[model samples]
Target: MLENLLPPLNDHNLPYPDTIHPIVVHFVIAMVLFAVFCDGVGYFSRNSKLYEVSWWNLFFATISIFVAVMFGQIEAGLALAYPASESTLNLHTILGWSLSGIIAAITAWRYVLRLRDPKTLPIGFIVVGVVLTVLVCFQVYLGDELVWVYGLHTVPVVEALKEGVL
Candidate 1:
């Protein structure tokens, strides 16, 4: 039934069209970075506006990360990843899931803080943001490795997989 309803899979093995994970992941990344930026600037500048912006960004990021992860899980399953890329793919998958939960918890914490005082942010929140940023950077590196170094679903790689070229 699903096979009949779905369109032809692309070279990347996607049903509808081009890879959607990367596109959605970009939004998540931008939101996370910008939220951290707003938190930092809001803290230093004593600007409540930046805090509000940060809150919204984090809130949206929390929602967007789930979307990103959902598509990532789908696309990863279709990637036909070879043995060489398996370890990295596994790690990326773990990190992706972890980030989703972390973002949700952090957003909940931010909501509490916002409700308490929009004008001031705790140093602890800023510290946690730094940790989150590092994790994001590492995840991005792993994702880049998958696409560039491993070429998980690129044309040549997919062709190689089909031809048993590794």
Candidate 2:
């Protein structure tokens, strides 16, 4: 009865053929990376002007990451993973949640720093930003593996599922 109300699954076995997670996540990834870049440049240039930009980017990223994670959880839950993709999918799920927490904590810490001294950001905070950038890069790699290698939600996989071959 519920299926009757829902839209028919598309070629990807998704209510809408395309996954929204990747689109939202790409924004989160870009914002976080850009925020880190702004911080690094601000630190090296000893310029306070970029701090505002960095703070705002991180602020938006903190919010966007949660949205990305929500879409990811929904899409991943709906994904029909083959045996080989299961471990990678599980790891991606775990890391996605972990990254969201880390981003939120760091954003909170940065907020406190902003409140303490709007004129200057701490060197330690910049260092942590560097670490966050590294982690984000790693997460991107995992996401690429899921899409490019494992082909999760790809046309062929979806077709196989439709054919009862998956």
Would you list the C-alpha lDDT of every candidate in the order shown? Answer: 0.91, 0.89
Candidate 1, residue 82: how far the Cα is off, in Å: 0.8
lDDT of 2: 0.89
lDDT of 2 by residue, 55-99 (tens): 999999999999999999988987878888899889988999999
Model 1, 12-116: lDDT tens per residue? 767866788999999999999999999999888888799989999999899999999999999899997988899999999999999999999999999999899
Question: TM-score of model 1 relative to the true fold?
Answer: 0.95
Give each model a TM-score.
Answer: 0.95, 0.95
State the displacement of the C-alpha of residue 53, model 1, in Å, after optimal TM-score superposition. Answer: 0.6
Best-matching candidate per TM-score = 1
lDDT of 1 at 107: 96
